[model samples]
Target: MHSLGFEPNEITYGSVLSACTAFQVPIFGKQVYSLAMKNGFFSNGYVRAGMIDLFSKNCSFEDALRVFHDVFCENVVCWNAIISGAVKNGENRVALDLFHEMCCGSFLPNSYTFSSILGACAALEELDVGKGVQGWVIKCGAGDVFVETAIVDLYAKCGLMGEAVEEFLQMPIRNVVSWTTVISGFVQTDDSTCALKFFKDMRELGVEINNYTVTSVVTACAKLAMIEEAIQVHSWILKAGFYSDAAVGAALINMYSKIGEFDLSMLVFKDVGSLKNPVVWVAMISASAQNQNPGEALEIFRKMLQESLRLDKFCISSLLSVIGCLNLGRQIHCYTLKTGLVSDVSVGSALLTTYSKSGSLEESHKVFEQILERDNVSWASMIAGFAEHGCADQAIKLFGEMLLEEIVPDQMTLTATLTACSALRSLQKGKEIHGYALRIGVGKDVVVGGALVTMYSKCGTLELAKSVFDMLPQKDQVARSSLISGYAQNGYIEKALMLFFDMLMADLAIDSFTVSSVLGAIALLNRSDIGTQMHALIAKMGLDSDISVGSSLVTMYSKCGSIEECRKAFDQIEKPDLIGWTAMIVSYAQHGKGTEALRLYDLMRKEGIKPDSVTFVGVLSACSHNGLVEEAYIHLNSMAKDHGIEPGYRHYACMIDLLGRSGRLKEAESFINDIPIKPDALVWGTLLAACKVHGDIELGKLAAKKVMELEPCDAGAYVSFSNICADVGQWEEVLKIRSLMKGTGVKKEPGWSFV
Candidate 1:
């Protein structure tokens, strides 16, 4: 067209310059600008507007402003170009400043100008400013097609769904983009039902759904786990032939990942072939991590490295998602070391998480210390890293150091530090951390707020936990679950139920975590009615698939003496993880089905599901409760010698109880002595109960003696010794046990049956 030599004018030069800007050919645009200047076309407002558009499009807003300043004939278009350029480049503050300058310069902002300013206001979270701009847009009588869409987007981003809806309804014309913006807003608020309804309404109105439309609605579906709707959206994507568009591909990837459809997510990722967008990579990585399939995330990361892309901050953040898989985590650390990505704070933090989760606290510390300057986030991350790895003291010290440095700890930092406090049972120190957290507005953080509730509850400060829980303006599932569990943990079963019902009133969805929390309350009450209602709720929600929820259900039923229900739930689980298997086996053990518990334990081993410490605790308990003397010893030996469990206190307690109950009193004593480590009061109590059952007064006395050393004034131990002495007709010994309990300044708690 240029070769035709038909004298090119302002529009022609503008189009050509815009093309150069789009392609980021700044040198070529500059050459054209110089040519336009020599021809005196720079004086033309249209030509100057084109130059501004070119620079802005190229993400060079400064260059755009330079062109605007040189224009002899400044107009509304030139000002709009400059303002729009700032918005496009994410220089929102600058865009707002320039808009103010334009308003004062006697050039009234047009509809497009108002839209750009609204975008800047939205980004700045200046909702009032956005409303003011909207008013001007209306007063100017330019509330047209493009303006309506822009306003919708601005309000949607600002979380003003009601106002966004009002704008959409009042608009003379509503397009697919405008509707999509509204749907996205609802999705952001987790109001998927509203989003779905709006999408249906758009379709009924004969709105032509494009890739963005489908992508927008798919987000709502994913949030609600609306599988059918998501699949339908996926089908529409195929029909629109938008499978190739990165936005469509990313939305599909995110949807599948959210719906527990990792296979489909991978299929989308592979079909997308080479994801160029770092956001797409993050979606895939986060999906894999969220689904507990870190291996796929790792594989994707490797493929990502092969592309013509450098791992950015998000790439490292994505890696952090899969640190639960220790081996892969270490591999990532090594990969980071090789690729020089360790210098980046995001990658460094991810590496720290990987090392910490893998029990390599020292390595995590090494990486953490390598960072010369740390942000509050970095300090929080290190504190969390230390706490998760059981380096409680270090976690506490780091939190203190963060304070000394005047880095006001956020919720994450305080929560992690409090977790360390809980692990150490440092109520005094935890209170101090809580005090600091309160001063800094830490309660706004869901996890820290929830952790504060649990920490105080665990530390036996129920009132303090109540205070924190009461102060939260909004309590999501995590917060509610934490508060409920804390209540149940502190024996406030009724309070837990009250909170659970309050959550329903708040319309918060009862997820697996919520059910699991209620299960704790059920366990505390041991009430069949509450347990049955909870089970019904679980069934209604189809949360039987959730391992934690399933485990909790089994536990609740087991404790409520509904062993048959526990068995049914256990049997229905398709592929029981160790926790599930342990829960079921423990249920059987609690119900006195020792052989059945042992059978499940064997089945677990046969399935290559190696039993963890909790698994062994149940197995040992089965043997101890049912007096399976030989079986207990065999399992104990297997746990230590074969499985390398190195029996914990509970395991030893199980062994001692098994021996003592079967009249092998001497064997019980020997077993306690032979444990790799010293046992706690629970171990001695188990043996003392067994002695009381067998009328072994001497052995009972010995067990009671050990209990007093472990727990200086154990009322149960005193009762057990007194009972054994009475059974053997030793009245004087019983009186001595009572007198000794009193002399220790011990106050025995009254036993009250729950149900």
Candidate 2:
């Protein structure tokens, strides 16, 4: 019209501005605004409302407000437009303020005004404000389907699902939006059964479902783990021609994965046929990882990269979850950095976790430090990394810093910090955290409760641990296992066994850790009969082949004097890892079958399993028991040369015992002196015990002196020295040793036998 030289009027400008707002053409809308201003159309309410909406929808809130103030007379259309625009711009509080100001003036709120204001209340989760708005909605007689749906949404978002449902039932006419709102509300509130029931009612009522409804139904099925319901929902989605919807497809993929139907998730992925949809790809990748198909997840990620799909934070986080090696993790981390996605907290936290899991704490810390906006997840991941890697001090310190920064610790953060406290045996810190947990209202949370039990157990406060366990509202597997393990660790073996029996009687799920803890208790009791029964249960439960369970069985049988059964259990492990191999070797060593232990160690090496420090301890113990001095020397050298494992104090003690058994007393003393690290009291005490066995009076005196120097209050050292003096007829020295023990207030510990 302008090109044809037709002068634009207020009506024409208003129509064009509405078109601009509809198309989201803010630049063109600005030009139209100038034309409307030049034509003096700002006085027209239609043009003014259109301009406010155009600017507000396009994130030009200042311009929208300017236009609102430019008009001399305030009208309801302009008021609704400005308030709705404020909401669209994410200025929820501003929208509320504008609504209050409009209410104090001449204009009363309409249905459209109520809808927008209720949306602001929903966004803010302001239940009180929403209730007030609902009252106003009724008093003004502005309650329509749109306003009612918004009210339902406000109640739902505020977690008042009962009120939302009650309001929904009162609606004389409900649309698809109303049904979807209530159904999705149930899903959001974690009432998946109610969500499913509502969906059923909707379908029976012949209410049409949209993609969001289908997505919500799928989520509900996933949460319930109702695979049949999920399948039915999938079929309905297909029939409704909503199968290609990205959100619905993602929800279906996640639902299938949650129900352990990875194949179905893959089928949905293939059928979606829209690789461009990042949500679908992310869901598939996450599903594969969640189902423990990391290789497949990585393969899907590679295909995603091949398709030139832009990687979002969720996509990056999902891909990071599947990374099994430091190299792969670094590759993804580098990709995130180049894409500037590393700045995203989710991606950064995922990279931190990936690096930590791959055994690169330095890289994990680096990523954590580089996260510009660290949330609870980033802090929790780093703390867990430090705890898992035995950097307990660092984890605790980081947790303290997190608190000082006033970042509220979530359940994972608290759990990880408790784990760090467990590892460090920091009882005071643990108790403080427990108090903090109660203060924050998560003390009764199951995960945190389990961590508390483990923490108190590890700190040797079994009573406190048991108290926490008893206070738990619902004891799950983790809490039960933690309490059981705590009992075993703190010498409350009978209590551990009783709890295991209670779990069995209750038919609670018995995982490998629970069985392992029970086996450990049985091992301490040397109850082969109980161990045998446990083995039977293990086989019945199809857990005999689990590596952790197998290791526990080996230790239990070995301690119970069932070496033959230990060997059989070891053989049952389909592919024994390092822990399994080490357990068998240690079991054989304990049984004095040193040659058998050596042979098994060789077999372990042949199977390409590299030995760790504990493996070497078992190897050295076998040599020590067998008096294989030459073999001990060779293995000790190989520990540093071949495996890059430094021989710890236990290895040194074993070597010294081997030399002393061979009557190479001089060689043993030289070995202790030559140890690169200072031998602790255990190493010296081992030598003193050897001297007592050999009746080497002079060497015994020197070894006892060293042990006393390293541990002055050790009554065992004093007793051993006194016994050595008595054997050599050194009466004067024996008397002096007894006097020294009296002066130091040392007393020999009474010996006991498990049998």
Candidate 3:
């Protein structure tokens, strides 16, 4: 107004003062006040009222009082202005004091004065003061419709919803605005159902809802996910001609997206394109991602970037889901880097996600390092990368680093970390993580809960797994599957079966993992009947085609001693992996069907299935059971040379047992001595047992001494030494071995059937 050359009028100053309050710019308000005073408008009640409104709107009550006192004669409107400003700006005590001062100066209070004082009481949450204002209202004869509306709003906000309703009932002339206030109050209080009923009643009385009414109603629909009701409200908004109003448009986008009506939301957005603000765009983009159309969201986001609209947290998060569309995601990541958006916490977190999805953990780490500010989400993404890349130790180390930085981990971090724990079988560290999770309230968290159960089960902590499962506040099919897998892993076949049956009876949707867990349990039990039932379910669910489930079923049937069923399941798998072959071979070896195990091992090689260390163990075991010492030796050396798998301890143990059982003690001894790695106690014990069988006293005694040095209290070693001495008629030596055993108090445990 001043730029137009004429002095700023009272109306312009009022507008400017309101602008200053809205923008939270107190300095601009002061500048305006100076200009007004220079124009001799200081004594102007309208100008002074604007200045008082400016000061009081920012909780500058002292300045407001100074403005009020400098005025020659403050009128009722001017007094109401300062009081209303003070109340809304969080100066409740000052508003009440000014009210009492007004009454003492013999200035009769109006309905506005009473309403302002009541609102102050509501802001301060002072029920006593609110009731006091009501008493004053009665005594001052100010109980009009407007005064009644303000008091109702105050009561409703202060949690006295009943009193607010009573105030409404007592009003003589209730307007549409007054009814809208009560409905909006109910919405804010989370009573959306009551708010909807009140809205219906207002419409039944032919009271047309303005923009605010439809906006609040749509927001409530969004919360309840009531698509039908939201559509009706949108239609009402269209009929009321508020379709293009920015607030109403933003609410419609959010409601439609939340209700899974992305198409309708887009239509509304395009219709209100001119009025679509940044919030509206964010809502639309988020809806697209939630509806699984992340590509479309990215396209829209590109347009937003083109228009130079600044992105907020939601905008960046929504775009991150499209990372599966790698080409587009890379472009976005580059754009983020170029624009220096990588420093933005949300954007940087999204960048981490994109790199993780692209299998570029190195790039993700680079981006994460560049983030000026990071949250747990960013830390979690980096940790998950380590887990995915088979770097469990690195994952654990990074988790420790996160703690050192004093950043609190949330549930997502816990879930990712448990994967690394299970891989390493680091039961000790995993338990400590579980303790921290419980301390931080992550125990009942849904995503983290199932993983915790899985980790404990994998680490042989069935009791802990069961405790975690039972303590869950709610359990979905994923949780049930995780618990069942835990039981199966820990050899609790009966418990696993019980949980699977219960899950089925509850009518929960069973995925491939659920079937796989049950099949594994049945396999462990060697129950062909249960395995067949699971196989039938696999066909019923049409999950026989999924590689993971099919492979598990193959393994299960093999372990149940049904070679035919195992072959059938294996053949049904479109692509048989090394796991399927290993399962069949190991099962045959276990049942002493050495010829069949050898034949399948050869077939696995001919079929181009890569053999792992476990496969070698099974193949070598087959040779041992059949007394094919030559064959076992050949495969053992071939394992490392051909397959590049270093002969692990189990492989070497099988080779030693094979040669020793065949009475090739010298050859076994030379093989043990020549192996690339040092032999464990089991290797030496195998030689000792063989020497005893052949009555080779000297060799047996020597092997036993070596074994005892490794494991001094080993009952097998003592027995081998004593047996050898007795076989050679060395009574004194036998007595000496017995004396050593008695001194250590070590008793040999009886052999029992293990599950």
> What stretches of model 3 exceed 4 Å from their correct place?
1-367, 388-390, 403-408, 421-442, 459-464, 588-611, 619-645, 658-664, 688-698, 717-740, 751-755
Candidate 2 wrongly placed segments (more than 4 Å): 1-170, 178-206, 216-240, 248-274, 290-293, 441-446, 463-484, 494-515, 528-550, 568-580, 602-610, 721-745, 750-755
Tens-place lDDT digits, model 1, residues 43-130 = 8777788788888886567778778777444678788888888998787989998888888887878888987888788787788888
Error of 2 at 178 (Å): 4.2
TM-score of 1: 0.71
Model 1 steric clash pairs: none
Q: By lDDT, rank the candidates, best first.
A: 2, 3, 1
Q: Which tens-of-lDDT digit does each residue in 206-243 have in candidate 2?
A: 99888888888888998545877778878888888898
Number of the predicted model whose lDDT against the real structure is largest: 2
Q: Give the Å shift of residue 550 in candidate 3.
A: 3.1
Q: Give the TM-score of candidate 3.
A: 0.54
Q: lDDT of each structure? A: 0.81, 0.90, 0.81
749: Cα error in model 3, Å: 3.5
Judging by TM-score, tell me the better candidate of 1 and 2.
Answer: 2
**TM values, all candidates:** 0.71, 0.76, 0.54
lDDT of 3 by residue, 283-317 (tens): 66767767878777777777787778775555566
